[model samples]
Target: MIITKYRFLILSIMILFSVKGQSQDKFKGYFEPAIDLSYQVNPKYGLSFGVENRNVIYSDKNMQYTVKQIDLSHFSEYQWHSKYAFGLGVQYRIEHAFDVDEESELRFQEQIVYTPERSGFETDHRVRIEQRLYASVTKHRFRYQLGYTIPLAQKQANEPYLKFDTESLLEIAKTQKPELEQRLGVGLGWFVSSKTTLQFGVEYQLENYTQQLNHELFLLAELGIEL
Candidate 1:
């Protein structure tokens, strides 16, 4: 129907604007235009994929949408009516930010791997990020994500040549063994119709390292069209 098409068009516009006007203070960068598509694999299952320009227009490269982690989700839902429902899913995230500042602000570059062993993991290393950012706002709503990763898992390498005696040394050797960066986030979504949603969020990361600390904050925008 004509009404349905109009709604989709509006939802798309919301995706563009939400990224710019969230808190109205700390978010003054990046409106990276992106294209997103989704498919219904089964009666109740769905999948989605998206791509965005690295240099988002109106965004600061120093404080823009650079990624550190990601999450793919499988969810189950309950519908109270066409207008409202709730769902749950599990997610995991790749770690970003290697260290933090004395003030606890995230320093982006320090997040790069250092040390001999760590350099290998950092060299052209990629994020196999997995995370579950929940959605329940049948109406316009927002949610925040908070998480942390910490010191050595206390494990030894399977490699024979690099046999280390103590847990501390092995962990220290691999700069990858960073104390967890605390993850903080908040986003808003508007339900344009029964199956279309527009979302936007801002996230701040904190890291602690041997030398000093680092800080970085990002504002992210997303568009989802449910099948």
Candidate 2:
């Protein structure tokens, strides 16, 4: 059963890659660096903060990078291992372009995560609600992410693993004309220390607003630190 499921996931990802390869013009490269810090206050509660810097790479060969966006967020969470977790947070974001003043955004968010036990794969489901505070418009968004983590080596923190995930986003506040976005990603992770882990991956994102069918590809790096 595990082998079958693994094959299915691989096949699906391959299909997506094949389709993306056919539309080369629509594909753009994104480079992101993100870091997260968390401190456990107790067994069931914690405070976390993170920042991510994103850049658009117009020329991969030349490595021409442009400032795209930066996100900063802080949150508090209550969670138990192999169980459920809840969080509340706020985020401040800045968006930039080649020739425009930076736009700022604020967001209040709430989330819940649940992990279910399995023999070969570890799976988790996360649902998040957000209130977007923009300069002109206010929007409410909801996101659901399904994630799978595969253990490759030792069970200790300083080990290696593989992760795959898919997430979908929906605009719920302005129900009249809803917008949507979807993402698929695969990453490899290494626990550098007991309190630190690093992940690198490629993500394919599809946007709903464009008439021409195109996708954005992102090279992602994530670091987590525990205190």
Candidate 3:
């Protein structure tokens, strides 16, 4: 059964890539790498810190293989119930820090996540609100994401898993009209040890879909560790 499920997942991913490849000329490619560390303070509370770096690998209008931004983030979560959790987070972003046109930003976030009891696959529903502060402007955004995790092997230290997620975002700023974006992602993850996980993924983003559509593709690598 697990093998069949894995085959289906692979076929679906291939189909998606094939369909999207038709418009590859219009898409920009980026690479993102990140690492996260989390500590469980108690049964109900947890804290996490993460850093992510993004670079443009292929783009028609922008310089290729250039540093785009780096983000430093921290979050705290409280599990209020078995199925629900609340979180607050802050992030500092350094935009084009390697170039002369460097800019900085601060963002604050509040979020809630719901995870029902596992039934074959685990699922998460998350809602988040963000306030972004730049040197000259402030913006507000709302986002919601649905994610699924499918175990490909029996529970063990070296288990493998598949993940799929979709997220919708709306941004509102005083200087510009509102914009809507959507993101779709698929990933494979491995439990390297009891406290370590590694993941590789691809995410496609449709930016400003309600207006002039911009297509972006991101290749992602992430490492997570629990303390």
Candidate 4:
């Protein structure tokens, strides 16, 4: 039990030291906007699609903005229980680069989610696995997210909520070394109507790379429509 309890902490401290030894720190900020749409065919099955665009700015001595990435994705979900669902998804992504070739990726994903009842506060958990295909490499990733939402108003349609979430990821590939990333976010979401929602948030990310660690802050907004 002691070993299990301290295993992650030990790993984190080691990684921190490793990252600190490499280079000086850098800070960056980003703005991301996304839209999603879903169709519910029945109580058990649904389909969703989404697009995302990301812009990053160097906030330090050099203040320049760049188009970072764009993504297009489609997914299908099956409800296994009243509060649980599974999904399969596919995505195409484009990443911009000035020095190297522009990178593109195809990703296939599977995910499961558990969400209990909704009242004053609701909590949810999600686990995901992905197979990522790049031009010269194939990678696999695992991610998990835990989130909570609290209703600002009574239990009614078209109400607003406050959301908080944290996520962690592990990536493995043959061409590149394994890496880990973590993110935390807070947001506000409103169900504008029976079939639509709007959300805006801020997120902080820490990513580990072969050479250095990356830290970023982002402002994000999303729109979801259900048909």
Tens-digit per-residue lDDT, 1-227, candidate 3: 74575565457556656766775436689999999999999999999999999999988856589888999999999999999999999999988466657658899999999999998899999999999998889999999998889888866769999898889999999998999998888899999998999999999888887877777889999999999
lDDT of 1 by residue, 1-227 (tens): 32352354345334534643442333223343334556766544444555443232233424434432333334443433333333443323223232122111111110111112232111111112222222211111122221111112224331111111101100121223434333344444555555665656554433332433344344566666766
Tell me the lDDT of model 2 at 146: 91
- The weakest ten consecutive residues by lDDT in model 4 span 1-10
Better of 3 and 4 by lDDT: 3
* Number of backbone-clashing residue pairs for each candidate, in the order shown: 24, 0, 0, 0
Best by TM-score: 3
Backbone steric clashes in candidate 2, count? 0
lDDT by residue (36-129, candidate 4, tens digit) is: 9999999899999999988877666466787888899999999989999999999998784532566688999999999988755788899999
- Name the regions of candidate 4 deviating beyond 4 angstroms: 1-24, 96-100, 155-158, 209-211
lDDT of 2 by residue, 30-79 (tens): 89999999999998899989999988885533567787888999999988
Cα lDDT, model 4, residue 159: 93
Measured against the true structure, the TM-scores of the candidates, in listed sequence, are: 0.35, 0.87, 0.89, 0.83
For TM-score, candidate 1 versus 4, the one ahead is: 4
User: Cα RMSD (Å) per model?
Assistant: 21.8, 3.0, 2.7, 6.3
